[model samples]
Target chain A: MTNLPQNEANDPFVDFSDVALRYGDENGTLALSGVDLSIKKGQFAAIVGPSGCGKSSFMKLATGLCPATEGSIRVAGAPVTGPLKITGMAFQNPTLLPWRDTLRNVMLPLEIVQPHRSRLRAEYAKYVAQAKTILATVGLAGFEDKHPWMLSGGMQQRVSLCRSLIHEPQLLMLDEPFAALDAFTREELWSVLQDLWLEKQFTCILVTHDLREAAYLADVIFVMSARPGRVISTHRVDIPRPRTIESTFDPAFVEIVQKIRAEIAQVRKESKAPARPAAQEQVQ
Target chain B: MKAKHRKLAEKLAPWVVIAGLFTIWQAAIFIFNPRPFILPSPALVYQSFIDYRDPIMAHALFTLTNTLIGFGLGILVGAMLGIFIGSSRLIYAGFYPLLIGINSVPKAAVVPLLVIWLGIGQPPAIATAFLLSFFPIAVNVAAGLATVEPELEDVLRSLGASKLDVLTKVSLPRSLPYFFASLKVAVTLAFVGAVISETLASNDGIGYLMLQAASQFRTSLMFAGLLVIAAMGIGTYLICAFIEVRMTGWATRKQTQVTGGG
Candidate 1:
């Protein structure tokens, strides 16, 4: 027991070892298998993969929304038994509560996560200030009182990002948070996210199919194989901080994106032969 | 500006239609000169309204009070049961069939049982109204909770929100529009239940007055009783509509563009 504690203490912020997830019953199809990975505290990591490669399942496992069928997963040095309190998540849809204005939506996590939850009513103004500051950080400062429907798509996503970070969780999980936006808005949000990450330094795991997004935002990129998905290769982005849209066209950035794309293409080819039957079954 | 004018026009349109209807009714009565018992003229009905104003008002007030009390209790019990059944699939499966069976039995049949159990008065009227109105509230509330976006639920659940917290904070608020919409249906049904009980077992209320008027050949008084009931129904419906709009203005704002022509 002492040895186990010591080992956990030395582990990274997020550590997944030989993790395999099978959906539904025991005989269910394996979504992911043999996934060993780790991320240092405060690091930004992105998982890029082809569609249907179980990238989302990896996120679900990390957040404890879905349990792993086999192997151990630890986050912040504690084994995940159920949904973790010290994590935040944003999705592609920017699912802000339609009834709540921007500020109220941002303050939602505070109403759920503790010790903030217990103190929220007594310290309501203090929490509102915190939410406003986060909203301002994401360029949603003046729109705090507007309902989600009143805002544009990019603005809604910014509010969503603020809501996810309001409680200041140790880990931030984003599942293609910018995929729904136009290219211009997507790039703008990338920088907004980068700035937020620079200021907060929370560990992030973004799952996306957008290679340029993975290249621009992540410190280290993990390219996933076709399902049953695994981290097939890792690419470190050693670009200096404050990198912008101009930097995305840099030779090094282009090369890293091309390399990952080639690897994904290779995985697709290998998995193609087996996937046909599954595709047919799905159609039927 | 255009939208505001259109809304005003919509509000006035119903009154214009009612006036036109009354004109045609009075004209037809003048032309045909039917017997008062067969069909009273609008003038005679107006005379009855003036003569029996006190009795009509009293009976109307009594019916309204019973309907309001029954409606309030129905909302409370129905909302509780709805939240309970909606939150868990097991409970929903167990209770839904039982609820449907209860709702299928005619509330008229239940009124006699209520009279047998509670005697012939406000209790039976209230019970009948409650039985008629509660089903819609229960069903709508459950449907509202059931239709909550899975993404929204996931966001809350992943934050370690308890089941109760999710229901109170998210599900309940999301269900407001549906709840209020069901109230419109429920309020009308509640009137039906109240009048049914009043006609069968109660000595008070517009239904009883109408029954008495019918026996005495006071056809104009019976028509007057019906008009009073209709006016009261409209009044309560307007109150419900006002509350619904105030509580769920956000939902309405989004769909306002689709609400042209009324």
Candidate 2:
């Protein structure tokens, strides 16, 4: 693939201009709208907002998993018509197939996505070795062949992470992939995820409700409003790489989290208020 | 060696149970105190079984072939059609109602009708078995296929999987457990169909042997024929059980494959 010059890549990885996401056909209810964002290449961007703020819908638009109803979405410099292969994803649930063992689950994407899919069996040994290495990196070395139900919640989520990164796509989209885990596990995965991003600079869009997670992991965190979600604030997390829990306690990081939470609380307050009174008739 | 010992111990328990059953049966016959012609002694029954063993074996082989072929056909067609229906909403909506309606019909009533069309030989019996067994397999497999984890579908779609790839790789493999689960019921039902058809009219089959012995007033021989029929049913049941175990041993959470989905 020929490289696009810096000017062309003003927003190479993901661009959504006045994007609107809606459910159902014409005359159906709106989901979200007026979403304007441009994520630069190699940026660890996270979308942080309340539960129903269309964060997941923004994810769908970015990866072409779902199309925008009224606005344009261009990912990697192409208009997304359907699901794109260059973007990898992990959802809230680790939806591993029950029939396959853990190692096979990790190898599943390579066995499907081309040009690797076309030569999977022939290069299987090499791919397996890579899988073992990646599994080891995530502290899941010994449980490669165990069925999903046999593993603990954190362990299964680790496998889910491996499955998403197996293909090493240009972009990684995460939709609350760690919400179900406990505090310790979630913090541990944050380190692993941080190390992975450090090594491979793929453009990542993380959709999460955890403000702390957003501040901890993201270089850029966009705070969206309540339903009909609009981006109201963007915080640049000026923290150093390889950060730890202590960093989360730092005044700067804590202040960012508090600010994002307050923004969300304000949005909630505005949403619940009575319908606005019309401006009194005034002479023009 | 431990496994072999376990097998032997398992085999011993059943034999001990059957011997106790035999003694009770023998005692019950004596309690009735009927004449030899009406209710033959256990010894007489055993001897008749030995005398008719070859003809019984021949008829048994005939019945086995028909039931196995028809059952195999039913499973294959049922599984394919079930997957197709489960994969598409339009197909599921259109075919599911028709399938239930067909399954509710009196399958036995159609045997004579199938006979008139296909001739009253193995053809009709095989057809009868197919008709009796296919619906359960189809319905169960379709249910399993439909319930395949949607999350896995998302994974495939994200990986640029074609529609056929999703169906064949994800949907089809996911349904095997359900397909095999229903097959146990189908095998028994298919055996019943074959036997009932054979009893209705057949030149030579275990069912025909039972009929002939009854007509000739050979009570002991008829009992022996009945014993053979029971053996065949038990034997088919075991075969299906073995296959289910061998194929799905790894697909189950329980390491022992014999007691899975079925």
Using DockQ, give the best candidate's number.
1
Give each model a TM-score: 0.92, 0.88
Clashes of 1: 0
User: What lDDT score is found at residue A106 in candidate 2?
Assistant: 85
Local lDDT at A239 for model 1: 86
Candidate 2's C-alpha runs over 4 A off are A1-3, A272-284, B1-48, B216-223, B255-262
Compose the digit string of candidate 1's lDDT tens values, residues B23-85.
999999999989989999999999999999999999999999889888998899888888888
Q: What proportion of the true contacts does each candidate reproduce? A: 0.68, 0.66
DockQ of each: 0.77, 0.57
Best by lDDT: 1
Single-chain TM-score of chain A, each candidate: 0.92, 0.94
Docking class of 1: medium
- Please list the residue runs of candidate 1 whose C-alpha ends up more than 4 Å from where it truly belongs after superposition: A1-10, A274-284, B1-4, B27-34, B255-262
Quality of model 2 by C-alpha lDDT: 0.82
Candidate 2 lDDT, tens digit per residue, A1-32? 42668787665578888888889987666777
**A99-212 per-residue lDDT for model 1 (tens digits):** 899899999999999899899999999999999888888888789899998899999999999999999888899999999999999999999999999998888999999999
